[model samples]
Target: MKHFFKIVYCIAILCIADTSYAQRKTAVKAKTTTVNAGLKLPTGFHASIIARDLGVARHMAVNSKGDIYVKMDRVKNSGGIIELSNPADNGIARKKTVFGEYGGTGIAIKNGYLYASSNSNIYRYKLNADEQVEDTGKAELIVSGLLDRGQHNSKSIALDNDGNIYVNIGAYSNSCQEHDRENGSKGMDPCPILDSAGGIWQFKADKQNQTYGDGVRYATGTRNVVGLDWNNEINSLFVMQHGRDQIGTMFPQFYEAKYADEIPAEEMFLVKKGMNFGWPYCYYDPMQNKKLLAPEYGGDGKQVGRCAEMEKPVVAFPAHMAPDGLLFYTGNMFPEKYKNGAFIAFHGSWNRNVTGQEGYFVAFVPFKDGKPSGKWEVFANGFAGVSKIESTGDAKYRPCGLAQAPDGSLYVSDDNKGNIWRITYKGK
Candidate 1:
């Protein structure tokens, strides 16, 4: 009987050890699953769901207090700017507030003021000591009566340390065609659209009720710029120009479908005063690495023509990436290699039919002394969460905007589902 009891006791010990080991394995699996739950980031980087259901969240800005203010492409409950705050560092916003009555794609905080823009106007609200907007109803109109002729009028903004605000006025027509993208139609020479559109304008950040006439035309000949930033190191503006479209549709004899899909590269320009980027008359061709005369302007796809004299891009990217946000890293929390580099949010392409869809990711361009030093890299990807995205509708999340927090984390906003992801680096 004693020997029988001893055998039973040994069996019980074995059973308990096996169960404990199983439990530990289950815990480790749960942790692995949780860590990989968000968007796929660079190794050693983690992305967490910070805010969701923000109603078409666009560009955003982080305040000194670590609060986030995001602009909305669609008005939610009659509000536009969404403020998210989490003082506990819990990786999620414990409080959410909505303010402002306009919906648009520009938001930034500068020098005790919060700035935002609609399609045709720019406004500013005073910030209190807590780095929050004092009153949404007291928004001061900085500029009004901007040209908003329906297409590409996002009016994205960037601020300089010198009290100037830069706002983009995108071209209404794709290439200033005589009949608007019709085959066999010639381009309107001297492109009348450049008068009120196709460039960035400088306005006073503190001025009120200013019109287009009050602002100075800072840069010209950019097709349509949604992503722009002020590089303090260079003390100049940098803009991502969305390349023109429909080369095959408008001039099938000159361009094949594949060439049209990938010919003109999306350009990043170091925009300075009186700089012309050769819009309507020329475009940057990545294959040849030269400015080619646009098909609408009396040349084949390979002709440089007068385009040889236009200002060239600092660097060119693949065609139709639709960069909507550009940010220069100046935070100490990131690696030293990332300091002063540029992060661009490619909002994804809509018309790259031949090559499928591309550019639903954030890219990093290493900059040294305010110039691009190395090739661009894909920093944050997997936002679409699909093997292939043939159409824009097939994308689950389209990255539209990027913001860097005070603590050096990055914030990405999705317009498709209005989700905000905060990415932080915590590796050796």
Candidate 2:
């Protein structure tokens, strides 16, 4: 923790002020400086950055008091969770403080305590009445030493209303076995990884030192679910999966080059306990519009036989868009049409050899009750810039994180250039 605060002290200096009034005013002043979003808004729709210049800010959660907590990568332990509090009415906020050097990828606020995860482990940080980081000595490991494959390593987390914390343990390999793409890369019989990796585990949110060795697998066979959210309306957990990569690169006969950009759909899964979405062995095909068997298990591009018993996605999207954040709208942030919709941050794609850029935008999937009711739409754009190519290569600002403010406003984080944007709507 000593090394953790050394970097934070410099960030805190920019936020601290001599007086309370000054702090609040600064927040509001920052709100008015936003770049215009055309003259179409009725009035009062404002957008601005909360905090900027941080590496690879991924998942984020806000507290009851409206403080923002972000799980950033590489700030010691790959990255510790940082808190931003006292957001101004004008939309300006400050990086208040940070703790928990264990640096896991998931962070959330549930039942008065702050929960954070590091690769290989999970921890619970106790907070005081003000909701500031209070030293409960060191954080208790809620779950530890999970499957820590360097690929797809950021473990996203979500908590059910019933007090169960769900953590993602992604599959280490691309497609399970080599028979996957090559002429003959055979899958491990029974794929033991399905038992541990490529799954979501449930643990007692208030318990102590509960490592992966003791936790129960809540769901299985997902590739890497980076965006996990609990919708109290449905009383279930929802996750957006970062789908598998390179169908043709690894296996040309099974899939063509065009299929790389147009094949699998990044899935929006409504995760229930004991659910399994097949990975390494199966993929959701946007072209054929069904779940297809992966090439690894002696299956071709269109076979669903290998995934007969697996679960399917609630909503389907284009391939390789890389959804990094998922949030359901419940606040008055936009029109009534958006009240129950889900906003997803597509971190963009690298698979398309066809043409130009995609996924450098935030998308919205409307939900009525618990099901998707309408086609998804682009909620925000301009991240790709006016004209550009070379996705995953020449991105100056890629949308990587999404968080809904307490006021129904949405915040998007850019990983390439470390900027946080608050997007709000005032028109009907």
| TM-scores for candidates 1 onward, in order | 0.91, 0.85
Q: Which regions of candidate 2 deviate over 4 angstroms?
A: 1-45, 76-79, 178-184
Writing each residue's lDDT as its tens digit, candidate 1 over 1-428 gives: 99999999999999999999999999856653466444677788877777777778899999988998989986787788888894327878754678889889989999999999999999999999999899878899999999988899899999999899999999998999988777778899999999999999999999999998899999889889989999999898999999998876778798889888886899999988889999989999898899999988887988999999999999899999899889999987788889999999999988887888889999999999999999999998877867698888888888888888888888889988888888888884
What count of clashes does model 2 give?
12
Superposition TM-score, candidate 1 onto the true structure? 0.91
Error of 1 at 404 (Å): 0.9
lDDT (CA) per prediction: 0.88, 0.76
Model 1 misplaced regions, further than 4 Å: 1-36
Counting clashing residue pairs in each candidate, in order, gives 0, 12
Best by TM-score: 1
